[model samples]
Target: MQIRPCADAFYASELEPWSEYISGQQGKDPGYDVLGWMIEETHKRGMEFHAWMNPYRISNSATAFATSGAANHPAKLHPEWTMKYDNLLIYRPALPEVKQHLLNVVDDLISKYDVDGIHFDDYFYPYPKGGVEIDDAADYAKYGAGYSNVGDFRRAQVDEVIEKIHNLLVAKKPGIVFSISPYGVWRNKASDPVAGSDSNSLQNYDDLYADVRKWCQNGWIDLVVPQLYASTSNVNMNFTKMCTWWNANSFEAKLAIGHALYRFGVPAEGAPYQTLDQLSDQFRISRSNKNTCGSFLFNATCFNENKINILSRLAQVYADKALIPVIGKESEAAPAKAGDIAVEGRTIAWKEQPGMRYAVYTVKPSSVEGKWDAKLTAVLAEPSWLAPGAGNYAVSVLNRDNAESELSQPVKVD
Candidate 1:
C-alpha cells in the first residue's frame, strides 16, 4: 500500500512540526493523521505499507487557491531552491539544500514511522512543458561546471538524490526498502540499441530526465515499480511487453508492475482499459513472469466505488495471504528461533527479537511435516497475536529483510 505522505505542499502528518502541510480537515478539533491510521490498518490486514512521496511537487497551480496555504509552505521559506514553470512549483534538484531537505523529510518518515519502504514515482522534472523551459538556468550556471548538457546535468542531480537517499536510508534503517517507480519505458529501441521495449511513449530517460535503468543497474533501490499504466492490449504500449522489458533489465532490484486499476473501464484517446478481462490477462502475464515480483495498484479508492465491480474481481487474485519478498542478498542472518509458544484462549505469545516481526502459521495435523506448505496465518509486529480461532499454530521470527527464521515448536489451540 502506498500512502501519499507529502504532496501538493501539504501532508498527511499529525506531528505538530508538519503543521506547515495541513490535511484541510484541521478544523475538526483534532488534526487527522492519515499516515498513522494507514500503517496500523495496513498491518492489521498483513500488508506491507509503503509511504509514497512526491519529492519535488509543491502547488499544483500557481494561481494560489486559499485552500493551499502556499504562503507558509516550506517552498516559500526556501524560495531559492524552487522553480516555477507551467503553473507548478517544483523544488530545484540541482541544489544541495534541496537534497538535504528531502533527506530530512524521508529520514523522518523512516525513523519515526513503521513503514516497510519509501517510494518515489517519476515526477522528478515535473513532466516537461512545451512552451516553458524549467527556470534552472541560474542553478546550471552555478553548479554545471563538470557537465556540458543541461539535461544530463539534471539527470545527475536526480541521481544524486537517489544515491544519497539510499545511502542514508541504509545507514539509518538498515532493513528499510527504498524504491523508485519511474515512467514505464526507459527508452525506445530507436533511442538506445540496448533498450528492449518497443514504444513511442514518452521515455523516462529522454523526457523525464530519469535514468531508471541506471538506478536498477547501480543497485540503488531495493525495488522498481514501473508505472505501466496502459491497456494490456494496446499495441504500441503493450503491458506484457513492458513487463518483459523491465524484468529483463532488473539488474539487482525486484520489479513490481504499477497496475492501472483506476484506468479500468475508463475512456482514453486511443485505447481504453474498458474491460476487466484486460486486467485479468495482465495479472496472468505478471504471475507467469519470474521477474515480476508483485503489483501495486494506482489508487486505493478505486475499489471503494465498486467501479465495474473491480473490488470483487481483484479480491479473487488477492484472496490468499502473500508475504513481502525479501531481497536475498540484502537480508541479514536469520534471527534466533522464536522461543516457547504459549496460547491462552485465542491469544498467543512468544519470545521475540527487538525489532523483528513474527509470522504465525497453522498446519493441519494430517499435513504437518518438517516442511510447512501452508502460508502464514498472521504476521504481527508485536511479540503476541490474537489468533483468529482454534488451530495448531507455530511462530517464526521475520528478520529485517523479511526473511523468516526457522519455525518454533507448534502449540495446539483449544
Candidate 2:
C-alpha cells in the first residue's frame, strides 16, 4: 500500500514510508492504527467509510515536501516518476509504473480494510499555471505517436488510468463503490457547443484532463459529486445552472451536489453564502432532480461551528436519517429481511446475512389508530443495538448497496 504507515507496528517494518512521522508527535504512537481505527469507528456508527485519495498530487508545497518526504518516500525513491511545479511534486501519469503504483495503493487499501468505497477528488493533471506549461512534449512524442495534439494524448492517459482502476475495483471487490468529485464544469457551451454546461468556468475536461462525464457514461464510477461552489447570482457559473447541468449529464452514476459550506459567512464570497437560506435553496434544487441522491458539504467542520446555524438548518432538512442510495442494475435486488428480532435486557439484536447493515428505527404513536410512525434511528453494522430508552423498535437489513429488506417483527419494551 502506498499509504503512509503511522502505526507503531510499522516502526520496524520495511514498508514504513519514513522514520520521521513515526518518531514525531502525530505519528508513531505507542500502538495507534490511524486509518484502520477511523474505518472501524465510522462503521460502528452505521456510516460507510470511503478513503479519499488524490491520484497525482505528491506534495502540497516545498515546505510539505521537506517536512513529509523522506529518503524512503516515493518522491525521493523514484524522482523520475515526479514533476515539480510551483514548489509542488506531482506523479507523472504517462508512466506505466506510476499507474501500477496507484492501482497497487488502491488494492492494498481495499484488501486490508473494510472500507465501503474508494474516492478520488478533482485533481487529475495539475491545475494550469498562467504563462507556464507542463513540459511533457518528449513523453508525448514517444507515447503520442499517432496523435496530433498533446492535450488529447494527455486526456487519453488519464482515461486509461480511471478505467483500469474501475476494472480493478470490480474484479477485486465488487461491493466497494468507486466515486469521483470533480470540478463542477465539464466544459462550457462556448467550448463544446453541442454538449456542455452553459456557464463559463474552468473546465475539468479542457483544463485538468479529468473526464468525469465519460466515467459516468461508461458506468465506471458509482457516484459523481460535482463541486458546484459558485454562488447562485454569479454570472460566470451560477450555482443552479451548474447543478442542473450536472443532473442533466448524470448517466449511470448517482449525482450529488457539493455545496461550499466553507464560504458561509465569508464576506468575500458575496451575499449568497452570507444569506441564511443559501444552502437550503441549493438543496431544494438538488431534490428537484430525480437523479440527485444527496448533497455533500465542502468542509465538514463547517457544521461543527454551526456558523450562521447551517448545521441546525441541516438538521431540519434531514430530519430522518436516510440510507445511502443504491445504484447500478446489480444493486437493485433487496437482501433477505432481518429475522429473530428480540430485545434481551438492554440490547436489541437481530439475525441477518453477512455484509449487511441494520437500519434501526424507533416506533412512535401515529395519528391513526392501529398504526405507528417509524423514524430511522441509525444504520448499524453490528447485529445488536442499545436504544436510548425503553420504546418500540424495529430492525431492517440493509445490504451493502443500502437496498433495505422488509422490517423485522417489531418488538416493544415493557
Candidate 3:
C-alpha cells in the first residue's frame, strides 16, 4: 500500500522534523509517523508498503506561496532551482545542486524511517509547452560539455540523480526496494522501434528526458510501474499492446502496470465514457504476462468513489482473498515461530507487536514423507481472526517490510 500524506500544512511543516524523531520511536506508531507509519501498518496486515514520493514537485500552485510558513517553504528559499515556463512552476532537474538536494531528502527519509521501498511516479520533468524552453542556460554554462545538445544534458542530470538515490538506498538499507512509474509512452514507433510507445503526442525519453529503459537495464530500480492509461481500442495508444511491450522491454526488475481508474466514466464532448469491460480487459492482459508482477490503482480517492461498480469488479477478481505481495528476493528474512494461540468460538486471537504481519496457515495429515505442507490461509490486520471454519491450523507472522521472522508454532482449529 502507498500512502500519500496530505500535501497541506500539517505534513509539510512536520516532514523534516518528523524524519528526525522517527528514528527514536520504532513501535509506538509504526505505521503513522513520517513514512514509517505506513510501512508498519502494512506489516501489521501482512502487506508490503512502498514509499511513494514526488522528486521535483515543490508546491501544487504558486498562489499558496505567500501563506506558506517560513521553515516549510521550498520555493522561497530556493528560487533559482525553479522554472516558470508559461504560468506553471516546476523544479529545475538540470542542476547538480538540485539533484544533490533531492537525494539528501530521500536519504533523510530512508535513514529515519523503517520503510519497505522507495517509489517515484510519472513526474520527472514538467509537461512540455510549445515554444518556450526550460530555463537551464545558467546550469548548462557551468556543467555542460561533450554533450552536443541541451536534451542530453537534461537526460544526464536525471540519470545522475536516480543512480545516486539507488546506490545510497541499497547501501544504507539493503532490505528496502526502489521503483519508478514513468509515463506510458517512451517514444512513438515512428521515432525508433526500441525508443517509445505507439502514441504520437509526447515521449518521456525525448521530451521529459526520462530514460526509463536505461534505468531499468542498469538496475537502478527494483520494479517499474509504467502508467498505461489508455484502452485497448484507443487509436493512438492501446493499453493491452503497451503492457506486452513493457513486459518484453523490462530488463530484470519486476514490472507492475499502473491503472487509471480515475478516468473510468469520464466523458468528453465526442468520446464516450469507458465501459467496465474496457477496464477489465486491461487487467486480463496484465494477468497473462508472467513477467508482470502485479497492478496498482492510480489514486486511493478514485478507487473509493466506486465508479460504475468498478471497485466491486476489481475486488471480486483480483482480491477475493487477502494476499502477501512478493517481496524483493534480496530482502527476504528468516521465518519466525508462532507463539501462544487461543480460540474463542470462531474468533482466534494472539498477542500483537511491532514489525510483525500475521499469516495463518493450515497443514493436513498424510502418509507420505514431508506431508506437512503449509498454505497461507489468512492475513490478519489485527492479531485476531473471526474466520468461518473448523480445521487444524497454525499461525505464522512475518515482517512484511523487512521479511525478517520465522514461522510461528501451529495452532489447531476445532
Candidate 4:
C-alpha cells in the first residue's frame, strides 16, 4: 500500500510516511517500514537503491478486473482518465488532471523513499497500435491550444510533464538522478531525414509521442539510456552504431545502454543473439563510446539464470571496481576528505562525516605509498567497514553527487 493516495489513489490504502522516525519505531508493527528496510539493506551492502516506476501503466491485462484491487484502481474509479488500448489500461496522457495526478504520484514517491535515483523506461504514450487511431482529438481540442498538429501537441504534453518532473526532482532532491530509457530509435531516417537514426525502426517521436531526443537535447533528464537491444553486427540497428549516435545527441546528460539480456540465449531471437558473445560485444561497444557511463540489463532477473554461463564473460570484463560516474549538479561542493583513518586488524574505521558515503579501496603493490590506482573495493554508507580479507585499505569520501575525494593514507594488514 502507498503511504499517500495520489490523483486516483491507484487502488491503494494510505500507509504511514517513510522516515527515520518511522523506521526507528520498527518493533511496533510487524509490517512496519518494509521500503525503509530495503533501502537500509541495499545501502548496507554497498549498492545503490533506485526506484523504478512505470508512470502511467494501470493494468497489464483485462483479467485484472477479477481482483478486488482492481475495483478501487484509479483506472476503474476515474475511467474517464483512462484508455483501453488493447487489453492494456493506461492513463490519458493529454489530460491536465492526469498530468497533475502523475506529478502528485511522483511527488509522493520521492518524498517518501530514500532512493538514490528515479528510473523511468520508455513507457510514455503507448506504442502506436495498428489500425487503432488515438481518439484523443477532443482532449487535444481542449488542451492543445498553442500546438499546431495533434502529434506536436501530444509530444508537447509529454514534454511539459517531463519538464515539470525534472523541476520537481531538482527542487526536492538535487543530488538524485532522474533517467529515462526510451526506444532506441528517436526516428528512422525515413521519418526525420536529418536527426533520425540510420536504421528503419519504430521511433520514440512520431509513434510513441515521446520526444526522447528532445529531452536529451533540452537537458531535462540526468541520463538518457536508449534500449539498444541489438547485436554489434545487426546491420539495420547495429548496437555500436546506435551507441555512437546516442552519445553525439546526449547533450549534458550521461548516456547508458539498455541490453536485452533476456534474449541472449534464446533461439527465436535470431542469429545475432544466438551467439553468447552478443552481450559482451554490446558491452565492448558501450565502453568504446566515451560518453557512456554505465549500462542497464533488461528483465534484471535474467542474470540469475546462470545455467547459460552468463557471468564468465562479464567477470573478466568487470574484474576491477570503478567509482560511479559523477552525476547531478556538476557544480555542487565536494565533501571534506576522510581523515584520522585507523586500522584494527581487517576492520577499518574513519572520521564520521555525516551525509557522505565512503569509498574503501584495497591497496595493491601499485597503489601503495600514495600512488593509488583507485580500484574501488567497496562503498559504505557507514563510517566503518570489515574488509573481506587481509590486505591494505584506504578510504575516500563521496558527496551525494558522487564526487570523490583523494584516497586517505593506506593502512597495512597481514
- Per-candidate Cα lDDT values, in order, are 0.76, 0.77, 0.69, 0.75
Clash tally, candidates in order? 0, 0, 17, 0
Stretches > 4 Å off in candidate 3: 1-42, 63-72, 195-197, 269-273, 336-354, 362-376, 381-387, 394-397, 401-412
Model 4 residue 151 lDDT?
92
Better of 1 and 2 by lDDT: 2
Per-residue C-alpha lDDT of model 3 across residues 1-414, encoded as one tens digit per residue = 433221111122233222212333211232443444455666665566677777776545455433532344444567787776655556788776677777777776677666678888887767887887777888788888878998888899899998898888778887778889999877788887765666675788888899998888888887899998877777677787789778988886779999888887676412423577777788899989889978888878867787778877787666545444554446545555656678888777777755566777766755886456666678766778876688767676766543434555556667
Per-residue lDDT tens digits for candidate 1, residues 191-236, read 8876647876888888888998998999899899899887776776
**TM-score of every model?**
0.86, 0.89, 0.82, 0.89
Q: Model 1 reaches what TM-score against the true structure?
A: 0.86
Per-residue alpha-carbon lDDT of model 2 for 1-414, expressed as tens digits? Answer: 123322112223333252344445322344666567777788777788877766877666646666655556665678787777677678788988888887777777677777788788788888888877786776787788877898888888899999998899888888788888898899999999988888888989999988888989999898999998887787878888888888889798989888889999878878888876887888888889888998878887787787787878788788878888775435425688888877878688887578778888888768998677888888887899888888898888888777888777679875
Among all candidates shown, the one with the greatest lDDT: 2
Query: Where is the poorest 10-residue window by lDDT in model 4?
Result: 3-12
lDDT of 2: 0.77
Q: Which stretches of candidate 1 lie over 4 Å from their true place?
A: 1-22, 25-47, 65-70, 267-272, 328-333, 343-349, 365-372, 382-391, 409-414
- Taking the tens digit of each residue's C-alpha lDDT, what string does model 4 give over 247-279? 888987889889888886777888877666777
Candidate 2 accuracy as TM-score: 0.89
- Candidate 1, after superposition: displacement of residue 100 in Å? 2.6
